[model samples]
Target: MDEVRVFPIIITKNKDSSEYPYFVEIPDIDGMTEGKSIADAMKMAEDYIGTFSLENKLPDSNTKLPRVEEGAVVTLVSVNVSEYKRKNDNRVVKKTISIPNYLNELGKENRINFSEVMTAALKKKLSV
Candidate 1:
């Protein structure tokens, strides 16, 4: 099957800060061999669907998976989000932020530039 025939995967930011090269996992398939990233995962899915069709003796074309027969319990697989930000800091985008009064006061007391303090805070939060 072509990449277009496979179910679309969702991508999300990882919450675990300790890990570098922020990674995402796919959950719909029995195993996570497919759909593990925004780009690579999509490619993997295409490969997987193609392999599945070949193994099942189906035409090697983009086609929806056939539904199970009636009276059989179908185990629906839930699609999971897959994506990760690149490990490199070059991916970072600069943005101006408005600091709250309390935060601004804290930065002033700490002898920190308001923007610098906020940038540090963001860096800590993002673990970059």
Candidate 2:
């Protein structure tokens, strides 16, 4: 099951630049990220919040919305922290496993990718 957290974000158009125009502010994490469009900005905000939540403890969503200025949009961004981490965390660690000598020799001879096989087996066993 995915644990979803919703955070409020303020998006404003960047008048200074046209290439990357949308700017997002995630107040809960005190984080800021920008994107090329509104949808992109929202996605970036979600990613920022997810990364922040994974790294640090996050406070409960603020019930009282922040004051919105003219031409600024306030919206809720929901992120599944667990799913986000699973999708975004790519750091790999080495693990030593003991396999039968014959199987190991066969795998080497067949040029099998042990990492891919292990990952697929684990994912299947875990039903992820």
Candidate 3:
């Protein structure tokens, strides 16, 4: 699957309240969220989609977008699924690894953090 996904969103003025003036509709996912401003609404939409992507519940992007209505703004919001998952999935797992005794001793002498080093190396190798 592509790392990034873009979805169409509709933003409308919330006539009911002035505090959160924007109402965002994510038609693709059949979801809605409110924001105090246009920028905030867009961000909420991205976050909502990112959460859904993590759950493997995102709908096909090829689905037809809802028709634009008067006084409503239609735009696209893009999220990098891989990046989102990397940032939000923070559970850590322990592993057992073996290395040369001399290298391990040298690392200990230098007070290196093995887990941190391994994480960095893995991230670089995977380009995440």
Candidate 4:
């Protein structure tokens, strides 16, 4: 597992959005994403961090979060990229696959899991 990292964030209230009022951004990161509440913003920030490759972020003295204004808040958010990948990469996606009728029938008769078998075969073929 990669070491857990804490990213500082600035959360600004959005008067323009009644539903999702929190606007969150990571100082060490380049983009901003929004959420409905403080907690939502925190989760969104973690996910946002997860979406970027490690090359995009570097912690330095310059990463010190900006001071919060009256309607804004500053906080630290933690994300373990390896843990996030472990938790998220297992999502199963529906895929339409084709096989020879004889092969399909043989697998069906033998009671095979198409999805699991296909995933394994793909992983082997792709060297993943």
**Per-candidate TM-score against the hidden true structure:** 0.26, 0.72, 0.67, 0.63
Residue 62, candidate 4: how far off, in angstroms? 8.7
* Residue 46 alpha-carbon offset, candidate 3, angstroms: 0.2
Write model 3 residue lDDT over 2-84, tens digit each, in one string: 48878899999989989999999998888899889999999999999898877776765643466887999888888888899
- Clash pairs detected, candidate 1: none
Q: Model 4: runs farther than 4 Å from truth? A: 54-63, 90-105, 108-128
Question: Candidate 4 lDDT, tens digit per residue, 86-118?
Answer: 655756789998899999999999999998899
Error of 2 at 67 (Å): 0.7
lDDT of 2 by residue, 1-128 (tens): 87888888999999998888999998878899998998999999988988887679878766456899999988888888889888878788799989999999999999999989998999899898
The whole-model C-alpha lDDT of candidate 4 against the native structure comes to 0.80
Clashing pairs in 3: none
Maximum-TM-score candidate: 2
Report the Cα RMSD per candidate: 14.4, 4.5, 5.3, 7.8
Instruction: Give candidate 1 regions above 4 Å deviation.
Output: 1-6, 10-31, 34-36, 57-128
Per-residue lDDT of 44 in model 3: 94
